[model samples]
Target: MIYSGTYTAIKADVPEFFMRKFIKLERIRANRESIQKKLNKKWLTCGIFTCVAAIAMIGSYRYISGIVKVSSNVNGKELPIYCVQTDEKKVALSFDAAWGNDDTQRILDILKEHNVHVTFFMTGGWVESYPDDVKAIYEAGHDLGNHSQNHKNMSQLSDEEKTQELMSVHEKVKELTGVKMQLFRPPYGDYDNAVVLNARENGYYPIQWDVDSLDWKDYGTDSILNTVLNHKALGNGSIILCHNGAKYTADALDALLDGLKEKGYQVVPISQLIYKENYHMDVTGRQIPDAK
Candidate 1:
């Protein structure tokens, strides 16, 4: 009987020992499962971080590529570059129409005939006087820029007056052609610090010609053509200034275009030539090219 009691006691101890072992095993499995879940969460977080970092890097690269700074000299003043640069052989044909609308159709015809594009800077008075000509200019796929209201010297005017001159022309042009003027060439190529600031405030780019035909001086066609031909070699990103009122200018237009073509220069608008920064004109009147 003593022996039978000892055997029962040993059997009870065996069952208790097994239950304790089973509990320990379960605890280990629970701990392992928790560790695995934590590892997965950490990996997911790393992936998300990597994706975000990649996107940020791509955005920064694009932002950097889209902007470029240029510096060039203008009339012996150092100016920052505010325009983009293109490798394309292009030249912008800009006409200052300060007086007379009779030759408007002729100008348009010449452009259309050559399938060439040009920019016309029209004064407010001229636009009001010749609405039909303005319409034809717009319809012909030509760009319209501002040349002030009354063809006054912008440099001589105060800041407020400059603003008025620009805004008045802007509004008038918009009303007449349903197009906004993005560029302004000061009347008589005259401008100052106030003019530049006022133009910037009003969101207009002040454009000046790199080459002057001097046709307004009644230079004969050959003389005007020679001036352009001589300065034409001045390189890319040149703005050639000519007037519509000059008979010689009209006569030289076709020849000048032909010469520009022969030289393999593509004529584009001034808006396409400048960068986005506020540039100060250099002593030589060229916008400095901004370092990328």
Candidate 2:
């Protein structure tokens, strides 16, 4: 009953029909995927461009104005109180003590003679090494700040490590001197956002220096004296950095104090010079009070 052309043709037509439809469906799917890839790439490029533009705008804003002062945190980055923004002709002299006690007594003697109170940033190692000197510094009424436990670069420390570094020294100093330190100076002046944030969490104000006495180079008395005295940044609310182990620091101490006094600069401890609350640090590390 099969018709020669009719039945044979219908049988062939059924398979051919499905094959064409299958090929067409495959083509549509391929085209859809191609479009999706192009769209994804375009979106990615746009997103990157937007981010770069935003960063550029923020950088421009910061440049035109000094660093944008926020609360304790600034755009997630924290800043240290380097110097105060005060019109009073006052400055803070700080000595970082990490090693060697030879100059400790001599420096203390000179400071006593001048009747000048300075801050001494001491580490836990320094405290353990010279407990007597630690007590002496506290007894002499100098600002004792925590300078970490091992003097490692705090920027590289983890949050827990930073807390330990800060608190270990904090406890050590408190136990030895009965004084709870509220100030912190990162070792070698090394700090990052995390370091400052950790310091805040531990209730310590991070400190930095505006004027540096290059006495650490053992640059002799004249060189040290000139650098400290003639620094262009020498002004009201300046913080000067010195090291207790510096070879010429003790030698330069007398001349340095006399020069500052002659210039009508009232040198005081960091505690007396810094504002504890409602302060913001400028790009130059000048801490300006919110009320000001």
lDDT of 1 by residue, 1-292 (tens): 3234544555665786775575567678878999999999999999999999999999998675443222233444423222334466766778898897666788778888889888899999989988888889899988899999988988788888888888898898899889989888888777666677678679877777777888889869899878987874446767788888787777788888888888888776666666557433445456554444
Clashing pairs in 2: none
lDDT of 2 by residue, 58-132 (tens): 999976454444455555657898788888999999999998889999999999999999999998999999999
* CA lDDT, candidate 1, residue 253: 81
Going through the candidates in the order shown, the clash numbers are 42, 0
270 Cα displacement, candidate 1 (Å): 2.2
* Top-TM-score candidate index: 2
What TM value does model 1 have? 0.69
Once fitted onto the true fold, the runs of candidate 2 whose alpha carbons sit more than 4 angstroms away are 1-76
lDDT of 1 at 226: 84
The lDDT per prediction is 0.75, 0.89
Query: Which candidate number has the best lDDT?
Result: 2
